[model samples]
Target: MRGTGKADVFVMLAHPVGHAKSPGIFNEIFEQKGLDSLMVPLSCRPEDFDTFWAGITAAENIRGVIISVPYKVPVYHKCAAAHDRAARVQSANSVRRQADGTWYADNFDGVGFIDGLKAGGHRIAGRRILQVGAGGAGASLTYC
Candidate 1:
């Protein structure tokens, strides 16, 4: 059950956020799970990123944030702790605020892709996978 005043806030931060579907997807998941959480989109430009991030992190109710596009690398550096995979790739798409007020970063883009493939009955174990592109997604997929 959620209190009327404030709920745990999860934000999706992006520069050109118009195409992002994360808010709706996570909001639906929260509602279905009966969690007192809300996912919101925060559109921020490169120059305004630092200030925007600082303001959001200052909020006690902020639970986590999903970084998109150019912000992923920046957010990865901002995190107090990072998963080894994220460190290896130098990118992070997910960040969670710990109880001690520190941020933990991880990359789940590759996991999600692999999960989708498994769900579709694709076998990956002992299989040689070749991935193209050396961009963020490619780096994450290759690392995972």
Candidate 2:
């Protein structure tokens, strides 16, 4: 289900998403900046995305959506065009369905991870990080 702009930002939280720290971080930023946006998590089951998005599309206040897990792969097919990397990887961690009914998908995990590592004071520019699995989640990192 989607919430209208009675609030500021709307975040779609997928299954097994209790581990997300975005709400805390974003909310804190919103509060600090005195912004009206409050990020609320949308608890959606895997099968309910299409049905949920139907109403979300009809709603007027949702700025965007943050996808996770199973939804990422599915959203790729649903979107009109995905970012180059997301197209190559066949997955997406974020999506935006525009007013003209065009969906754009992009993967931000790789950059986020690298940035986080660097911000944590780790030197990986000329280093190697071993990843045991080079499967779905490793698609973006394999080349990094």
TM-score of each: 0.87, 0.75
lDDT tens string, model 1, 16-72?
A: 887889999998888889888888888878998889889888998999998888788
lDDT of 2 by residue, 54-141 (tens): 7666765565677776677776777777877788887777777677856687877667777888899999877767777544356755
What overall lDDT goes with each candidate model? 0.85, 0.70
TM-score of 2: 0.75
RMSD after Cα superposition, model 1: 2.0
Worst 10 residues of 1 by lDDT: 1-10
Instruction: Report lDDT (Cα) of residue 27, candidate 1.
Output: 89
TM-score computed on alpha carbons, candidate 1: 0.87
